[model samples]
Target: MIGTWVSILPPLIAIVMVLATKRVLLSLGSGILTAALLVASFAPVETVKHLWSALTVSFWADGELNTYNIFIMVFVLFLGIITAFVSLSGGSRAFADWAVRHIKTRRGAKLLTVFLGLLIFVDDYFNSLAVGQVSRPITDKHRISRAKLAYFIDSTSAPICVVSPISSWGAFLIGQLALILGTTTAVNYSPLSAFLMMAPMNFYVIATLAMVFFFAWTNIDFFTMKKHEEIAQKTGQLFDPEKEIPGQLKEDFPEHNYGRVLDLVAPILTLVAVTLGMMVWTGYRATQSLNIWAIFENTDVPLSLVTGGLIGTLLAAILYIAQMGRNETASYRLVGKALSTGVKAMMPAILILLLAWSLTYLIDILETGPFLSTVVEKSNIPVNFLPVIMFILAGLMAFSTGTSWGSFGILLPIAGTIMINAAPELLLPALSAVLAGAVFGDHCSPISDTTILSSTGAGSNHIDHVATQLPYALIAAAIASFGYIILGLTGSVWVGLIGVILSIVVLFTIWTVKSRRQIELTT
Candidate 1:
C-alpha cells in the first residue's frame, strides 16, 4: 500500500467533500467508508459491513477505544461539571470582579485574558469558556470588540493546552506516541521529554500568544477587526451584525443568586493538587523509584487526569455545599443542579471529541499514516523543505476537519514516521511544525469547536469572530511557515528563534501598512 497511490484519495476526498458540502459528519463518513472499501479491495458488500461496524463500534470497542481514551472522555465530562459549578457558585463572576479592578486599561485587560487562558491549561473547551467568562466584562469596559475578545480566548486555549506537559492535549499526544514507539526502546527520550523540547519550536503557538500583546499594546488592526474596533469606540456596538453575523451563546451565565471567588479558587487548587499527586503516585507505581525526572517521564497521564478530575469535582461540590449552607436537602440540591448544568454545557464539546476520535480510528484502518509517509518520502521534495510541506498539509487537513486533535492524531504518526526514517535529527522541528500547523488551521477554521466556544464565551457573533480572527491567525501562520523553512535550511533551533523575531517584525510591518492605507482612505 506504500506505493498504492489510490490510498491517498480518502483523506483528500474527505477534505474536498467538506469544502463542497460543509458537512463534517457526511465528509468523515464518506472518508471512512471509502477507506473501508479500499481495505476490502472494492468488495461493495464487505465495505458496507465494515463501514457499519466502524461507525457503530470503533470508539467503544477494545482495539480502538482503549483505556486512555475512556479516561480522557471521563476526565472531560468531570471537567465540564467543574466549570459549571464554578460558574454557578459565582466563583467565576467573583474572580472577574477581582481581576477587573487591577485591569485599568485595554492592554491590561487583554493581557489578563492571555494570563487567565494560560492558567486554565487543562482543556481547550474549559479554557475558552472560563477565560471568556472572566475577561468579557473587562474587555467590554475598555471598548474592545467582542471579536477581539473572542480572538484572545480562542487563541490561548488550544495553543496553551497542546504545549502544557500535564494537560489533556499532552496526554492525548503521548497516548498516540506511545502507540507508535511502544514500550520498546526506539528513542532515547520519553514522549513527554520530546514533547517539551518540541514545545518551543511550535512557531504558531509562540507567535499566537505574542500576537495578542502586539494587537493589545499597539492598538492596531489590519483587517475588518479595525472597523469593529472603531464601531465599538464610536457607537458602543460590540456585537455589530452589519460587519458580520456570528453565532454565540444566548445567555452568558445562568441566573444565580449566590457564589464567591473562593468557590472558584478552591476547586482549581484542589484539581491541580490531585493531578500532581496522582502523577507522582502513577510514576512510583510504574518505576518503583522516587526519582522526580523518572516519575515525570513514566507517569500515566490519562489515569492521573481521571483520578484527579473525579476527586476535584467531588471536592468542589463539597465546598459549594458548605458555602451555600442551608437545609441539608437544599444544599445537596444546589450542588447537584450545578453539576448537571456543567455536564450539560459540556455536551456539545464531548460529542465533538467523540466524533473526532471515531474518525481517527477509521482513518487508522486505512493506514493513512503509512500512506502519507511513503508519499512524502518518494516525492521529489527535498528534505530541507519537509517541515514546510508538513505544516501546510497538516494545516489544510485540520482546517478541513475542523479539529486540531483529529488532524494531530492522523498527521503526527505520519510526520513521526517520516522524520524518524528519513531524518531522525529533524524529529523535534518536524513534530513542532505538524503541531503548529494543526493549531493554526484549527484557529482559522470556522467549524472548529474552540472557535465556536470562543464566540460563545465572548458573546460575539460567530461569523464576526471568524472574520476578525482570520487575519491575525493568517499573520501568525505566514510567519510560522517561514520559521519552518529557516529551521529546515539551517537545521538549528536558534534559526527557529530567529523566525519568531522575524514574525513579530512582519506582523508590525503589516499593521503599519494597514494603518497607512486606512489613513489614506479617510483623506
Candidate 2:
C-alpha cells in the first residue's frame, strides 16, 4: 500500500505544480523525473538494478523505430509542412474570406466555425490550425473571445477524430484493437463500426458539440464571457480591448477580399481531395500484398498522416504560386523559408509528443495499472458499477500518461479480457468506457497535443485555455459516467438514449443557470 502511494505521487505532484505555476513543459518534466525517483526510492537495490536493466530493455524493445512509429512521425511532419504552405499561400486566409462573405452574422460565424471544425476531421493537427486560422478573423469581427474559439477547436478536434471514420484516429483504433484481439482476422472493429459503436458512448464529445451550438447561438458562458459581456454593454464598447486584436494589426491584414480568399481555398480543397484519393489507393494497393484478413498488417499511422499533410501542402503551394503571377510567385528561397517556418511551428507539438511518450513510460514504471486493478477489485462496488469504475480507471491512467492511445493500448486489452471472463454481455459498454475515459483524460491533460494546439490556435495562454476547458469536460464526464452505469443496467442503445437525454438536460441546465445569472446581474 505504501509502495502504491509512492507510485502515484509523481503525477499528482506534477498536476499541482502545473496548476500553481502554469508552466506546462516544466510540470510534465518534473512529473517524469518524480516517477523515475519513485521507482528508485521504494524498491530494493536489486529491484532498482533490475529496473534500470528493464528501462534499457524496454527502450530497445519499443518498436518506435519500427515502420509504424516512423510512418506516424512522418505524417505529423508532413501535415505541419502542408499547414505552413496553407498559411503562407493564404489558402487558410482565402477560406476565411469566403466564409466571412457567406456568414455575415455573429451567430452564423460561430455556427460555421463549428461546422468547419467537423469538416476537417481528416486529422486533429489539421483541424486545430485550419479551424483557428480560417475562423479567427470572423470570430474577432464578432467580438467572440479567442478563448471561446479555442474551446470550439479543442473540443471538436479529438471529439471529431474519436468519432469520425477515415482519420488517423480511426486507423490507430483499428491497429490497437487488432493488437489486443491477436487473430488479425479483421475483427469486428472496422473504422465505421468503431465510429458508430463509440459515438454514443462518447458522451463528453457529443455533449460538447451540442453545447457549442447552444452557446454560439445564445452567447452564454457562466464565468468569464458573461462578465465580459456585461462590461461591454455597460461601457458601450462591443469589443473588449483586453480580448480584441488591435485595430492597427487588423489594418495590416484586412479581412477577406475575394481573390485573396480564393488563393487560400483552392489549394486546401485540392489537398483534401487528393488525400482521400491517396487513402483509397493505399488501401487498394495494400490488398495486392496481403490478404483481406490482414488488412492492417503493417499499416502505417505516422506515414499516412505525414503523406496526406505533405501532399496537401505541395498542392497548396503550387496553387499559391500559380495565383501569384510569375513575378510575384514564390521563389525557391522563399519556399524553403516557408517550409522551414512550417516545420518550426510543429517543433513544440513534436517535443510535447516525445515527452508525452516518456510520461507513459513513467506511469508504467510507477505500476499504475496493477495499482488500479487492485483498487477496483477491492472496492466492493456493485457489479453494475464496473463500467463506471473502468471509466474512472481509464481516465486516471490516460491523464497520467498524457496519451489516450497508450492508455487505450493497455486498458483495452485488460478490459477485453475482463469482458470475456466477468461479463461478456457488458463487452461493448466496457470498451465504450475505455474509449470515453481515455479521450476525456486526453482532452483535459495539459501535456496533450490537442490542449497545446488549442492554446496556439487561440493565441491564449495554455493555462488559461486549460482552466476554461476543465469545468466543461468534467461536467460532461459526470453525465457520461452515469450513462455508462445505465448501459450496464440496460443495453447499448438504451444507454445511448438515456445519455442523449441526460446530456441535453445537463447542457441546457448549465446554460440556463449561467444565462439567467447574467441577466440578473445586468438588470
Candidate 3:
C-alpha cells in the first residue's frame, strides 16, 4: 500500500468519519488503526507495534527527544495557564467591558480581529492563539460566534505568514526555495528576490484575504457559519453549550473589583515581545550574522514560543496574585485551582493535536505525499495548464496529509523542475501556486494543526469550526483557481490578480442583490 493509490485511504477515511460522526478522536483513531493494519499487512501484533511507534514518535524520534513537538505542546499548556490567570484576575471581564464601550458594533469587533490576525504574522501558531486571546472578549461582547472568530483567525494566520518574509512560514519556504533554485541553472534570481516576487503571484492569499475583509465588514455569511452567527445573535450563545470546546475554562473564578484593561494587555504584549526577541536572539546565535532575513531563517521558532509562553504565564500569574491585596474575592487557594483548571481547559486540544500528529506521521510513512507528487510529475499536461494543475495537486496532497509544510517539502522542487524544463518563465508562478494551494487545503483540512489551534484559540467546538469554515474556504479556492488559470494562460501576474479581484467583486455583487431580495420578502 505504501507509495500507491491505497496509501490515500486512511486520510479519506478519517475525514469522512469526522464529518459523519463529529467524533474527532474516534475518527483519528480509526485512521491510525487502519493505517497500521495496512502497514503491518493485517497482522494484529505488528499492527499494535506500528501503532505504538506512531503514537510515541511525537515524543521521541531517532533516539532523541522530539523538541519541536514537545515544546509546541508546552507552549499550548502555558498559553492555557496564561488565559486562566487573566480571567482569574478579572482581565477578561475588564477587557470585554472596555472593548464594548469603544468598539460599539459587531462589525467593529470582527474588523478588530482581522487587524490582529494580520498584525501577528511572525508565526501562524502564535498568530492564531495571541489574536484569539486579545480579540475574543471584544468579539464575544458583540455576539460574534466562536466559529466565525475561528474562521477569521484561520484565514489570516497562514495567509499572512505565507507571504511575509519575516515569518516562520516564509523563512522555511525561502530555505526550500534556495535549495530548489540551486539545482537549476535556468533561474538567476536569488532566493529572497524570488520569494518577494512570488508574494503577489500567490493568488489564493489575495483572494482569501479579500474575502476575509469583505466578510468582516459586511457580516455576509452562509452555510454552517450563517447558522452559527444567527444563533449567536439571537441568544448570546457563541457556541453550542453542549459541544466540547477546547481552551474554554470549565470553572468560573471570581472577578476582582479593581481589575483593569492593563491586566489583559500587559501579558499579551510580553508574550509577543519576548517571543520575537527570542527568535532574533536564537537566529543570531546560530548564524553569527546581523541580516534580519538570515536571523528569521535560522531562528528556533519552537524554542522561542516556549520561552515567550513561560514569561507570559509568569506575568499573568503575578497579575492574579496582585489582585489578592485589593480584592476581597481573591484568595491564595484559587491560584492552585487556576493552574489545574488551565491544564484541564487545554486537554481536549492537546489530545486532538497529538492524535492528528500521529495520523500525519503514519500517513508520511505510507508515502501518500510522494505518491501524489509522483502523479503530478508524471502528468503530460500542456505548459499553459501546468500552474493550475500544480495548484490542484498541491491542494489535494496537503488536504490528504493534513500538513502544508509536508506538501511544500515534497512538491516545491518538483514544481521548480517541471516549470524550468517546460517553460522557465512560469517557474515562480507555478511555485506560488503550490504555496497558495497548500494553504487552501490546510484551511479546509479537519486534521490540520493550524485548523485545530484556531478552534482552540476561539474556544469553538473543533468540528463546528471545520464545518463552518469549509464553505468560505471553497469560495476563495474557486476564485484562486480561476486566477491561476488566467495566470497560466496569460503568463502575467497582474492579469491573474485582476481576475481574482473581479471574481470576488462579481460574486459579492450577485450575493448582495440576492440578499436585498430576501430582505424585501421577509419585510
Stretches of candidate 3 off by over 4 Å are none
| 222-333: candidate 1 lDDT, tens digit per residue | 6789898988988888876543222222224444546677777777667667876887788789889986655655778778778877887887777666754542333556
Which candidate has the top score in lDDT? 3
**What's the residue-level lDDT of 383 in candidate 1?**
79
- Give lDDT tens digits, candidate 2, residues 341-391: 656655555555555555556677677766765676667676667788788
lDDT of 2 at 411: 82
lDDT of each: 0.72, 0.64, 0.93
**Any idea how many clashes model 1 has?**
5
- TM-score for each model: 0.73, 0.78, 0.99
At residue 490, candidate 3 shows an lDDT of 94
In candidate 2, which residue ranges exceed 4 Å CA deviation? 1-3, 39-94, 122-126, 171-198, 224-259, 287-299, 323-337, 457-460, 489-496, 506-510, 513-517, 520-523
Q: After best superposition, candidate 2 residue 388: deviation in angstroms?
A: 1.1
Cα lDDT tens digits for candidate 3, 179-229:
989988998999999999999989889989988998899867899899999
As for model 2, its CA RMSD to the true structure in angstroms is: 5.7
